[model samples]
Target: MLKTALFGLAAATQAIALATIQAKGSKLFTSDGNQFYIKGIAYQLTEDDPLAQGDQCKLDATLMKTLGANSIRVYHVDPTADHDACMSAFSDAGIYAWIDVDTFSTYILPDNPEWNETMYDAYASVIDAFHNYDNVAGFYVGNEVLTTGASSIAAPYVKAAARDMKAYRDSKGYRSIPVGYSAADIADLRPNLQNYLACGSNSSESLDFFALNAYEWCGQSDFETSGYTFLQQNASDYNIPIYFSETGCNTPKPRTFDDQAAILGSDMADSWSGAIIYEWIQEANDYGLISYGPSAAATATNAVGGYTRSGTPTPISPDFDNLSNHWKTLTPSGVSMSAYNPSASAPSCPAFTSGNWLVSGNVPLPTLGDAFKASGSSSGSSSGTSSGTVSASPSSSRAGTGGSSASAAPSSTGEAAAATSSAAAMRNGVPVIAQWAVWLGGR
Candidate 1:
């Protein structure tokens, strides 16, 4: 314990007094005083996808660099995914990484240190493996770790783990990297964050800044994720800065890329320091602005940075229309990460037009744990500002509209393709508008 405490002390000194938090309304400052603006995509690092693994990686990275993309949110890694190749591509391309915590569906209890230990060991191993990379922004601890609202116990493990991980990184004398889990928004993560921070009287001490995956799906209204406005208003209590680990949105509403953007674009403008879209290739369903060449649904060969208007969106040979029209609502400059005050209390959102989205029979209120699984996903939090989010991870990804569901993500080759195909087919599986997917061509 003395060793752990000492280690913690040393680690704290390294990052303390440095004060760089990316909360709503605050500039996104890194531990190194670096101010960042994210413009990228959430793509797989699998060998099958030319954008990530093999020779295609060169093509993929080149396209991103050409287009203006500065980062790639790496998720779902396979054994043959070419880890070094992917990271190298991002690094050489000058792209940041919205790295995830391996797979998802984590709900380890604090008392279950054995379980916690096992998971943390693996989690730490990944962090250790990548922390040294300059391009890496930080670690995204869990993907909807509390989706089910089913964990009878609110584990303070995350807070404890954050401290332990920091110590582990520092004992060996390493620079501090931002670290935290990714929830769609604070409402989904409230349980975990609150419990994690409540570990001791000095709760905030355990974790670094918080991270959010603020992807607003279609049928959504003018709203930021639920707690962002609250956080902005109460920035003093939740002083921890927030890095948008992921913020994606589908476009064109029902068809291809609709010229109309979400009404919440203002919320994004005024509420974040860093955020990235989830795609680049203009594929079917208005997800990617360009296609990966082999998409069975789209074949419209659009130039790197093609359309900038609302007219017939150059289709990307997509298979389904499971997307929301978000790109249509940019602040004109596109990809705005500057901070602003929360809206004058957000009004009721479209998703929540109906009372409570979650079907009480399936998912009870005051969601306990399992941050990634919502049976009948709901929208809006009656507490003034409206914010509702859905979680997607390698283990299980959920869709928010009416019928939210979860499925284990594939980790191997054949299986991964199936997941990808299924995701493309289901259309509903579209990730929240990840604001970081724009495929960049130039600096």
Candidate 2:
């Protein structure tokens, strides 16, 4: 009887562990083959390692679960900190994490972008830190890196970062964690920037997924009027998973979140995966669904210009209830991985215009070391000279209901080894702890 009881408890623990999310063509799926939609919130408290606060994470995870959220997007974390407690807390609550690999100092700057060794080491260290966790959904290479037409010159470097990161993930014998980018919703940069990042003939060079930080749908707006119709139509033929990395515009007094219906509803679910709300806390930007500290102390300000509060998470009344209500009613059941077949062809690389897209469609992406190679070309020894066009194939017919048609890639077979001590950890010729100190001051 004692042995049976212990085995049952262990089985229950394993049952609750979050499954790995995989990108199938333009949609996302769970390891069990069920289609997955991200009902997520953007969670970042400090500019540094937010996940390092395990006690706070435990408290917030319970509140998020009550809010009906299944995922959280964390913008930054200390690669060297122990995340077992927080990650385990979220996983036990059936929540997954979509983390950003680049830190504030390591991110590629538009004015002076370069995919060098320093950036590569920083990104690789983060991956090494979190890749073992089953609850990690994916990693964003850079967020809003290219906002304007002139800044579009940095496109190639961004692509190179994705390429090298994917390569490092593969070479380390780690699971095939998806690597992607998040773009600012700029009218002129749309479709072009999206196409450029996923355009390369080489599958290795193309982003595993793409995301956009959109806020066009303000309070009390419908799908067609909010410009989401145009956004969906443009993404109808995209070949990889795409979603709203950051959303929820807070202009009017109280937000209604009407766009939530259109996003997870039949209108856009076929073309898009899901969305993550702009924020969790009421900061200076004022998009939080909840605030921290006592209700009377909500007015207190912090040194960084955000609301100053700590302790229990206090939901900001109607805003919290509004989002919770939408999530409760709108449950989208996407198609099963077995039934779906991906037919969207790779989009043709966008042509360059003087000020709009500075890089020519034919120009090779910037390369790092001898790791990157164009789809149909040889290995790259130098930078920006690799060449080849990934030929476009026939397009598939759009589905009326459920997820769009797309074939699922084989699930990752790599198993994580036991965690090693920081002193002994080494990857790509750099000690993991040494890299952490250089980039994050050993946070």
Candidate 3:
């Protein structure tokens, strides 16, 4: 008991003092009641734990500060690994983290989706791991889970993931860290997906926020020409905070990032929170603002495999300067939370349409122990292989959770068995039960 108490004290001391960002009626607010905007960049390099390397995180956090970024969206992280170094580094730099709870093996795939016990436990573990951090802005239950309209059948499972994650956060007595989803911005699935996630009467089940991976604004494009006008119009009355989970088109070279001006300017800042650029590293996608190694060694193919992520960082030419210039000039001071009154009501859930939207608004979202199976198998019972417990060691070869991975085998008895196994798993040499007790002691 004394050892656990000391551990809790150390954890508390390591936590940096960053204001918790909260979602309140179509806007985000800081602890002091000021409207918070997410001027962030996606910060995932390798498939494994990006934040595990403390030195690398410090390097990136320093550069991100120069770019005037206040938040970062990490696509994947190992829940078991100690994130104190990276989390503290970012927090000390006044940066917040919007972490995705799902992993390569644990996410809900669009074509073959499931809201099983393994997924639930994976999401829950992530929440438990980062809930203690003061700079954790939010957690994304899944990213681009439903890409095309044909795969919209998976909407219930996505919603269920959010519901269960939120419930798990509450059950653990953790701060109300926003749990939300990031969509792929499909035209046919437009307002339907957005409205469906935020519509339901049960606020507990509804998403705390919604994010879109929008890249409609190409080089030198205006709000209307880029289709942002339509997007702002569609989401004008949304009840929850919304922003771009991913953006920055690189097709026309140089990548001006004109959308930055529009997103932070008067046109959309009132309606939208803020946007996170596509990514930080100079990857194969060519959207990176900074490369890892020497300019000569940076290859256009498989940047993750080719570049050296360690030593001094190198800025990716005019692209980096362009984003910096935009951020330096555009500053949006949102309304104070104290004087702000939320009048927008939750939008009605979109009615199901064949081939476009499959999940009917009338049907209840898939429940873990009810309509949704624990194994995500067609059969009612699982095969006992799907424990949903993440390996104690993080996998380096695995792909990012934002993309698809081979599905796990089915499980038996679903939620109960998986939860029991998860609770038994060791974290930082302490059982989850004991760790929770320690966390509670700190509070």
Candidate 4:
């Protein structure tokens, strides 16, 4: 029998074909081939249960529409639930969704970063659950995995999972659903990470897009003053689309959301796709653009990670009003994929710069770990072939001709082992992200 999600998709597709967004150069395009920009908010719920919040989602959809939100990014979802009603609410309100596949229990933490079949299966389930929904914009392969320079070793495994998932989608004949990563604001290594992910033409190995969870811009800041100029300059030559997966600084209690003007304005439009505000509901960290009120406190225990709420839902913070007012006059650009140069080669891979940890920019990344092989081979699974045939560099092409795709499997003789790196311990210089860990846990 068709599942609720599949049935709803079939019905919805027939009634009104929604545009599935695709990455094109530094921008995004829709099914009708129109250009689109994200004016979204990061949203989960005061109550953590995605399956049971259909009614609540519907209610929130109305508020989001009122705030002029065109999209929402959800950190996690229950694959087993019937999300038709909630998804429908968002769709009806003309809102799109970009979702995360990993959660706290089943995540690729830096301390013990290992990508195996178990992880693959869980991620695949997320794709399976949401692939049918037209309004579902994309999937985040991993959120802020490379939170520090030492975490660079996990890059290959994360890239491997992305390669495999894209292949699975292709195998099932799905559209070009953008699969990307959400990076933390580790300025020192941000450029290298972005360049590395987009270094190869083997589309399977490269992320379709890239996002940054940035909080640099606070009250009353401009492009140059806020360090956005540097970000713009650094990404000037990048081949893939990039945007703020999460933004909206929260230094002052009532965030004015002043960054919205510059983010949605003409200054950074060409270089950036757009932005998704940090959050919807207030949490202990207080980054929310809106407050659900103290009555929603009962759900706070499950909503946020670190801080416990003692008071009733505070009145909608002034940030929401500022955000709403700003969005009222904001006019996003139309979708255009024409500038996309399909023949353009990807950026050359960065040389392994010896940061506090070793980094390998080699392409045809290490094969699917031995643990994930269907045949139980000690090597990568044969099913994990890259979509593009070309290698990112001449040396990479000549270097033992690794995997079937650009993600070459390690040679039996250890000839191509240099292409792989080992995980590093979480030592000093690793940013203190207790709040981030807690927030991700609940999501």
Candidate 5:
């Protein structure tokens, strides 16, 4: 017993020594101040409770290390769980976490997002849950909340939430945890949303970085053809960091994952940071790079808009090996962190023009509501509910809209052919269409 305690103590000490990451200008830096790039994967164990699954995380972390991953992004976290064990497990394994603070249903509905005290309380609770972990890289205020042109109204509220989170962190005297947003890759509105988020100069109103769930690069594509060139040109003068919050195209089976090269390569390194793959475990969506456990599940079903597995020991897909090989050869930029101009002012907000999707050049940000002032805690008091067990159902990779039954995404593979197809047909299974389908359904 004494020997076990000693070993645990040593492990804790080592975990505590991991470097904390911070954002300076458009780049990330380690505590020792080396430039950091994200080589990550989306990890959501919806079937298991994250709070009670430290062992599972250890199991996951071991494989992540083998894949040469440096980070992991988890979309929904149960704010009530004690994340120290799992967080420590990742830290010890040299993996960082970029977590989202909101939930799939109640917290911040995209169509009618409210930056109220209740939302603030929830955000604060999430911060308290992971703030102590050295490897907690950053927090995403919202994910694809502002995916479509209609959802543009949610922008101000998203910024408000980010502002409040920053203020909350300062009030509690915590490290400057980067707060940002993850947008959907809506071709028409993509540039406008990124510009708007990075326009405000007030630290409270501005985003630390911007991310887009881009899947434009399909099978055998190049930068210009994939629309990355246009993306770089549009965001050329933005003040905050930008990256692919979620990427990895799924239309072509046995995905070669060629985008990994351009994303982490020298050509686009100036304009983008590293990207996180869409997912780690296979689900009904058919996006996962591996199965849940060590061995292949015997009966994997592809119903319910995603693939479901039934059996012990999940299997790793060929995509994993394809991606791992790419990761092994890919070299992240070693740009000096000191080269960034921290005192630089932000670009002016894009003006609201007729026919364009941008809102007023200077939209007023929401203030922290009074409801939270009377009932919340930024003075280091515990905030989120501490449910010691897994309470919610497993979430689908494709999140449903808040209140509506929507259209389907584009369902075919041939791009030009699909584009010319009926809008209804286009809405069947295409990711872009899927995004709109979800929004349309909720409406």
Candidate 6:
């Protein structure tokens, strides 16, 4: 069996190499002729926290596989660790990975010969050690270095890092790997949009793709409405393709499963190069769909009410059923501006269970961990109104019939239990979420 797995890995690597992937026309395509909008979520190491309220059992990779998602943005890349096994899991499962360099400072300090040498060594080590991992798609050179611009800024590090790494790869005859960098959600947030966007030199050299991390905080409009379009316009001016590395918002609190899907799916459709959601697992701040709970969630009454951190999870998105409802209206229904109440803010929410430990203000949006608290204190009462019409208003938050609240956090465990109970429940007004679900089961 050991020999067979190794043989299978080698075969898989060859298959991945032979798989012709195209980065063209505002989207990507696979050899199988599948149109990829880069619909995916950022999976995290959050569940690894021993005291996390998450259900450990439900955190399964299979959930991502079933969602039709094509990629995952791993936040860290440590070459010496079991990264091969990590990348291999996704590779074998047919999921793409956008691996990130360990730190923002690494990319920014390239001008300093000493720091440059250190950064280069770390980068080269990972590229050389893990480049063979079939699932590795691209390198996310720097994270949000531009967000907190100052003497501490790391913009220069990018140019130097890219040059050094590319040179090293070429020296070793390393194969072609699509290179890229991500900007803080808004273009202006990045120190220099004009130059940063030029990281890939119009996708001609320094980079092959561009990434943006747009988070809709208290803004009345989707970031894409202003953010993506502006970048897309610039990319058009530069003739380069842009990928929204991360795009999501938190206005619909107690986020129903469908709402979760809608927020993520909408941005993907809105962007030209496609996008991936902030996170894949629940963190201290938000409910990541998958987790583990104690014992058998396989049975009905055996389930614990809340925060078991026990069962393995399966996730389902909030907007899983209402595919057309998402992002179709640039702003979500509950958090948009309106002619009736134009003065209303986008609505605020509380921090997660563990978030209390920090000095929390209204965070724009976290990197990829527990991204949001419940949508709003009003529980999505004041919906977001945008140029599009599908926006739901706060007046609609009432539960007209008997069931879950209109804005309950999406839960796959509920769906799983329902699944075993009867087929009739699934069809009879019960919401169905198409996203991933991992049952968290713990001791």
Best by lDDT: 3
Q: How do the residues 1-443 of candidate 6 rate in per-residue lDDT, one tens digit apiece?
A: 01012454364322334243344333344544554446566654422221122232123445556555667776544455534344444555567767665332233321111123444565677677656655566776655434322211224334345545656667888555566676654333332432343433123334445676655432244435434445544444332345666644434543322322323444433235556665554433343444444333434343323333334554535532222233243332222112122221111222212311111222221111111122222221111111110111110110010011111123232211100101111224543321211111120
- Poorest 10 consecutive residues of model 3 by lDDT? 434-443
Poorly placed runs, candidate 6 (over 4 Å): 1-36, 46-59, 103-115, 148-153, 187-191, 194-205, 217-228, 254-271, 294-311, 316-443
Q: If the candidates were sorted by their lDDT against the true structure, best first, what order would they fall in?
A: 3, 2, 5, 4, 6, 1
Give Cα-based local distance difference scores for all models: 0.38, 0.70, 0.71, 0.63, 0.63, 0.40
Query: Model 1 over residues 50-111: C-alpha lDDT tens digits?
Result: 22344556666765665566667665333233255556665677666656544322323211
**Residue 126 of candidate 2: its Cα lDDT?**
94
Q: Scored by Cα lDDT, where does model 2 land?
A: 0.70
For candidate 1, the 10 contiguous residues with the lowest summed lDDT are 417-426
TM-scores for candidates 1 onward, in order: 0.53, 0.79, 0.82, 0.76, 0.77, 0.55
Supply candidate 2's per-residue lDDT for 420.
14
Which ranges of candidate 2 are over 4 A from the true structure? 1-16, 294-306, 369-443
Error of 2 at 209 (Å): 0.6
Model 5 lDDT, full chain set: 0.63
Residues 61-179, model 5: lDDT tens digits: 87888888889988767777657667867877799999888654334444434455556776798888778777888898876665556656557767778888988998999889899
Off by over 4 Å in 4: 1-16, 46-52, 295-315, 338-344, 370-443
What is the overall TM-score of model 6 with all chains considered together? 0.55
Task: Show where candidate 1 strays beyond 4 Å.
Answer: 1-27, 30-32, 45-54, 77-82, 104-114, 152-155, 185-205, 217-237, 251-271, 280-286, 295-443
Candidate 4 per-residue lDDT over residues 262-370, each given as its tens digit: 7777776666778898777655445555555533333455333333322223337577778889888777664456645544457876666555233445634544342
Q: For residues 45-159, write the lDDT of model 3, one tens digit per residue.
A: 6666888888889888898999899999887788888787788789878999999998756666565455556668788988888887888999998776665665676677688
Off by over 4 Å in 5: 1-15, 47-51, 293-315, 342-345, 354-358, 370-395, 398-443
In candidate 3, residue 37 scores what lDDT? Answer: 85
